[model samples]
Target: MSGRQLYFKCECLQKGGAFKFRGACNAVFSLNDEDASKGVVTHSSGNHAAALALAAKLRGIPSYIVIPKNAPTCKIENVKRYGGQIVWSEASVQSREEVANKVWQETGAIFIHPYNDGRILSGQGTISLEILEQVPHIDTLVVPISGGGLISGIALAAKSINPAIRIFAAEPKGANDAALSKAAGRIIRLPETDTIADGLRAFLGDFTWPVVRDLVEDIITVEDSEIIKATKLCFEILKVVVEPSGAIGLAAVLSDTFQKNPSWKECNHIGIVISGGNVDLAVLWDSLKKGK
Candidate 1:
């Protein structure tokens, strides 16, 4: 939105329609044949569930997904299409974990956490690995954070290659636990949240919190309206259909956060990660009407 130059690292175009595929693939493949034979299990609202299901299918292994009842219909279809056995639960974090734990216990399946696993971090890290190669002189990266996998991986990889790049996180204000945690200098969890960024509603995981706290320079939270506005812009201007969670990075730029920061002036070349492209067309049309 500013006069400064910005480049987009479009992970929305990645497989399974999100960068979660990278982590899911890595986590699934890291398992041995005997382990994979027992199958794999996970709890997710959408993207990660679909990714892990697809990953398991590719490895010729079984997948059992514990999906929240509120998860998107398209995403549920994706998991089922990938041959994952679906188990439903309430939308709470407690409900998701309990259902997954039961499935894991019954099947003795390997549990691949959406963001808490190290192998998943390694897989997601590959995104920045490519960004640096393509844009060697990039001075800053703007990424969306939910459970923090994408930002954690990108921050770690990008800094390792060129310690010069500054990493920033874009989060929704309605579910701004990450931003709150950053400001508090410790981890924080919300018992509840309300936001259109469904993929980003989860509280930050323990493993991801440390990496995000240490490596991330700052986090900027935008209102739900701001998120919708950015989502509209992505579709109308960029000709790319981005979900609410995916558009938060561009929303951060349009918000006062980027402009108010003195550090932003130092960043001549910035990279923005388009985290996913799984917006429901029904919701997209509704958001478009609101944006107008």
Candidate 2:
């Protein structure tokens, strides 16, 4: 770890405290004046909700956010602070979708999917653009996979700029849909997510499947404990406060997953995308103290 450097494209520090802002802003601004006047709606538990809310505010349009009732307090506050109109739903994925669709139908608000839109992908790809500009040469780009939006965008962008640069994904073992989907050659949805990384609970979307399947070099999964440990490591070593989901890429790196890879022999410089930083500090501390 002495001579080796792990450079990070810190989206955690971005507006609304996550990379979701880029996509949200793109989606919001993509609408024409006529359609934009009706505003937009989205189903999200945390970061995306806050992002879309803020984006709509900047565009001077309304934002309807469908959130799970059990979503984190901090994230809920962020959405409210951004002036998002809240629509409560059950924790089930179906409920979230149903509510968002209902709002869009009733209000004629444009439905801006969190990760399935083309414009969203283009906006998220800007992260790779910035990375390339900031760090010209790197062996690989490691991104955390949720619904595959971030990874798919980064893969497409990075591969276009540097075909030799490898793009890898870090996913949670408990919610291993991305890995399973990549292997089965299709998007796979888990019955339920079982990880502390709340932001990554969603399965891959239609738009991101092909991009991730074709461009990503590999997908590595880590346990919840590994993510928590990696989160602490980021704070201790890198002096960065990263949430569990945000630190999964580092978790994969610190684990044997990377070292065991065939590409490890040739890869020296690595670039990681720190996806978000909206974690609840009390929960993290309690979990760490209890060793769970």
Candidate 3:
């Protein structure tokens, strides 16, 4: 546990069981009446697919979701339940994007990039507004980083409100492109990723990279084992069923890098974003049974 006072912004409790709902909702609703009628399309591993589907349903429009064939069964069900037309693709980004593009072209659905749109970024930023309002004097925020929408929006809004507030990205060591990008002063994509935090495997995008580069203070990378431990802790201690990606912020805060750094001492009150709670129950039960 961290010595500093900790605050959790539980976006996992949101409509679609993830902070992804905020961005998806904003994007879907921002469309003009004509565009909305034509439907919306996007590619996602899980959460965003479900979020966009639910948002489109609320707006009385169709949602075409391009999902990797390997996505969790529970998440695929979420999309179906929310009335999305599912299109399957290979797990790779190129395959996902290619399928999404083909769907958009065929259906004339407005293409919604998972984390690279202005509307989505603005919507994700709302989390920071609520966090600052609730924790007026909080000094630092630890956010999970995937394609960078959540942290980019949070850093932009939080820094604008209190220019000195620190923003750190909690990234999976297996998918540490954000960390590499920060070090290299540009986006960096890995050849392949291997992490249990399935939702955090994405690299930064053009729309999000600028905000991350300018406003984020640091990146704290944690191993998959650490993420798993933090996920279990969320269920046992926090009484929250957080997915591995959602628990990465807590993992980062409790990691040696954050704990031993003297510079981090100034962050007396740290806020952690619990970004989602869409774990596969079968995997969870199996892990618990195996004492993982």
C-alpha root-mean-square deviation, each candidate: 1.2, 1.2, 1.1
Which tens-of-lDDT digit does each residue in 1-292 have in candidate 3?
A: 6888999999889998999999999999888999999999999999999999999999999999999999989899999999999999999999999999999889899999889888899889999999999999999999999999999888888988999999999999899999999999999999999988899998899999999899999999998878888888999999988888999999999999999999998999999999999989898677656644
Model 1: residues with Cα > 4 Å off, grouped in runs: none
lDDT of 1: 0.89
Worst 10 residues of 2 by lDDT: 1-10
Name the 10 consecutive residues with the lowest summed lDDT in model 1: 283-292
Q: Which is the leading candidate under lDDT?
A: 3
> Residue-wise lDDT of candidate 2 within 153-221, one digit each (tens)?
888888999999988899999999999999999888999889889989988998999999899988999
lDDT score at residue 11, model 2, on the 0-100 scale: 83
lDDT of 1 by residue, 210-282 (tens): 9999999999999998989888888888888788899989899878878878767787788889988877889
Q: Candidate 2, which segments miss by more than 4 Å at Cα? A: none
